[model samples]
Target: MSNSQITAVTELDRSHYKTKVYSGGHFIYADEPTDVGGTDEGMPPAALLLASLGSCTAITIRMYADRKNYNLDSIKIDLAICKEEEMNKDTTITRKIEFTGDLTEDERQRLFVIADKCPIHKMLSNPIKIVTS
Candidate 1:
């Protein structure tokens, strides 16, 4: 984020949707399930999107818990993208968060407020423009 922008490179050969993605000093693979004509090597793109949001939500809450001196043992986040009939072409992400900690209801409520401020959540909630040539 400090660099203002991030870059990643992905290469796809003849292996259907299987692809290798390289980002800075890190690398990952993206693949579809065999039921969808892929080799089922890795998570599909949509899953990665959910993973990003869930991880960010957890990390943000953990940071707040540590700063507030709360006993936060673990955080579980479940994310799903669903399409409702009322909203056309709109993707709705259902995020279910579970917290394991010794804290008051106020503290837990604060975490719910803080979760929305995560970087990924902010990015996805706002307008996005992707350019390709």
Candidate 2:
């Protein structure tokens, strides 16, 4: 087992329903929307989770294409995520990748295979342990 550890810190501001998160010198704010009594200061936790998955998928595909010297102009990834309680608290995330460039069908199809191979995708598909104090 790997002993490597990654950590982040978040503090809640007393004034509003917002959180300040610090990780590796980057600061992120997370909050609930105004409809839920928050000031809509930043992205909700759900959106943040979805963004991580989508961005990771795009970068993975881009890196693979670049390694092969594929002429890829643009890449677009769209993901929709939802939680279902009926399935014993199961969550589903659907991803759609759009590539804009001169590419063959095989290249495009190969990207689909590569998308699922992203680290984040693998993490989500597998079991994870979350320990909180």
Candidate 3:
């Protein structure tokens, strides 16, 4: 993999937890729900994490299928993260994939394997350390 670094910046004001995120010349909003004292303007932090994984998985599968000349129409991914009550326990993330295409059972199984090959999935499956300065 190329040694590339991605930098993202976020700004949060007194607007009840609504945050502005900027990366790669793009911008998006992250906010908490109204019940949590946010304006509910956009996806929360947890949802954003799942969105990243889902998009990466779908893109990886699509690229693989196209490269191998598989009859792939579309890909749908559903992801949910379950937080553990005990802090020491690991959190569970459930991902369900649906494909609309003409593929054999073997191909389907291979796609399942390919899903795990996504960069985000690999990153999440491994150990991560966040350093704050």
lDDT per model vs. reference: 0.88, 0.85, 0.91
Q: Per-residue lDDT for 94 in model 3?
A: 92
Per-residue C-alpha lDDT of model 2 across residues 81-119, encoded as one tens digit per residue: 774333344767888899999999999999899999988
lDDT (0-100) at residue 131 of candidate 3?
94
What is the C-alpha lDDT profile of model 1 across 1-133, one tens digit per residue? 3555778899999998899989888988999989779988888888888999999999999998999998889999999885334544477889999999797999889999999989999999988899999
Estimate, for each residue in 1-133, the C-alpha lDDT of model 3 and write its tens digit: 2368978999997888999999989999999999879999989998999999999999999989999998989999999986424324378789999999899998899999999999999999999999999
Please tell me which model should have the higher lDDT, number 1 or number 3: 3
Q: What is the lDDT of residue 66 in candidate 2?
A: 99
Q: What ranges in model 2 sit over 4 Å off? A: 1-4, 83-88
lDDT of model number 3: 0.91
Query: What is candidate 2's local distance difference test score?
Result: 0.85
Off by over 4 Å in 3: 1-3, 83-88
User: Considering TM-score, where higher is better, how would the candidates rank from best to worst?
Assistant: 3, 1, 2
Lowest summed lDDT over 10 consecutive residues: which window, candidate 1?
82-91
| lDDT at 127, model 2 | 90
